[model samples]
Target: MLNPFSIEGEWFKGNLHLHTTGSDGKVTPQEAITSYAAHGYDFLAITDHRQVTEIDGLDHKGMLMIPGIEMDGGQTDLNGSYHMVAMGAKGPMSYDSGWSAQELIDYGNENAEFVFIAHPYWLSLTLADMIDLEGYIGLEVYNTTCHYGVGRGDSGPHWDDLLARGKRLYGFGVDDAHFGYADAWVGYTMVKAEKCEYDDIIAAMKAGNFYASNGPTISNLQCDGNKMLVECSPCWEIRVVCPLPGRGTTTYRSGHKPPFTEVEFEIREGTDPIRIECIDEVGNKAWSNPMWLSE
Candidate 1:
């Protein structure tokens, strides 16, 4: 197991997925950045439609704005649907008519980019199958912009399954903030990066150093070789859950209400994938993706 202190060092907070006027979104990239900046988000990705914008000189004050694009290939089906997000890549990506989800993932992988399966539950795409590919970097656990009952359930299970299979897949919760009927900033992927820089934040996210949230904020989290240590809002009940290697879940629940609540649990070795979820006093909860250990 890795040292606990190093895991907590210099973790930055950010939102990896969002939409703007470059696509079907109502707000412009600048407007979206402004709103998120005011809300204390350190990084934001403007992933517009099938097109990637060239916001070369655009600046978001101290905040980092990453250029990205969302793509669609083939049609939606009960077993499989296709929509993807590619980040940190230059020039046009392949938009072939005869492309499968795995084909798209291969193209992204060869070009060295980040690939995220968007709104899996909403689209009802067989995410478990797509996750089998090593190139498929991440999955969206919660898409706040989508209709409430559109997809399967929350994406937490999708991420858990990937970890259960011993895959180091990352999880992302996006606002998909189109600024439409749904309220903007409802869901966000909180990244635990080394710094607020572009590469650091992206690297952390690609490595699954993140948690998804609607409103609640997580202050501190630590997982030693044996004990998982977490601290969060005292006003709500907190649940720390980890997917055990044998297809079961290890959970610890604690309730408190101010200064800080410390929760700990002993986890089995080799079942290193862990997630921390904060349930607010009113029952609203936010979840972090599985933080994988052992490289």
Candidate 2:
């Protein structure tokens, strides 16, 4: 399926996970919304710690504001932690630490548009810890704060592992911006929606009509049978990744040659859900949602 590309609509840039002075962030709600709006963000969610941060009266500066919250509770298989980002809620929620991770996930899925795991690599979450959780939309494939503060940001492997094991999930990239470090404007989810309205944006996101990016742009992505084509900004490498090793291919930019803007690959047989990655020269990357041929 060509998905968002073939689905129709305008591309809207949004940051799903963000913090403000209402939580542990340095900036106030006004500052956070104003800054993001000024930075050309089409939409934003104020996912403060444990609360949605009340956006009704905020100026929002003509930008679409989605209600969100980030909460950590429950013990994992390794007794680690579970952090969840919940969006599209009409009100804030409170949960005791006594709740299990599954409990939080179930609640979010029931009450919100959808919820996602926040920074799986940063939390050191294992495949075992997350594989059983139901109703989660996906995990944070890239978190700006986690990368800058702890150097454990990228969660591509975590996403790959889950996909390989037959878990259908999307990926999200967010700033998780606290401003304690330079995190904002570093990561985003580009959603293709028919309008800038709140419901349309959330509906598009719920449908996975989007891609996660730190810098690179994925202008087009299409798959026909076993053959896939991706059109992106000039990048150093374009890789076709499969669940099984040796079934994928990578095209690297020739030294001193022009960067490649497009690449096509005939996927190996029976690769099921095919995924692709585009990596720019400076290490910035963009990821496509997994595509299942069977679907």
Top-scoring candidate (TM-score): 2
TM-score computed on alpha carbons, candidate 1:
0.83
Among residues 3 or more apart in sequence or in different chains, the pairs in candidate 1 whose N, CA or C atoms overlap within 3 Å are 121-151, 211-288, 234-256, 234-257
lDDT of model 2, residue 151: 90
1-295: candidate 2 lDDT, tens digit per residue: 5267778799999999999998999999999999999999999999999887888888989899999889789897778879999898767788776788999988787768889999999999998998888899889999999988999888999998898988888899899999887899889999999999988999888888899999999998888877778899999888787766556777842233438797777777787777778899998999888887667
Which segments of candidate 2 are over 4 A away from where they belong? 253-258
lDDT (10s digit) by residue, model 1, range 1-295: 2222347546555666667788788888888888888887777777777777666677685788777777777555464557787877566554674677777767766653688888776776664555555577778877776634354436676677666767766667777777876646667776765677877777776666667777677777676667777666663556555666452232322333333366676666665666777777665457766666565
Candidate 1, residue 71: Cα displacement in angstroms equals 1.3
Give each model a TM-score. 0.83, 0.96
Where does the lowest 10-residue lDDT sum fall in candidate 1?
247-256
Q: Each model's C-alpha lDDT?
A: 0.67, 0.86
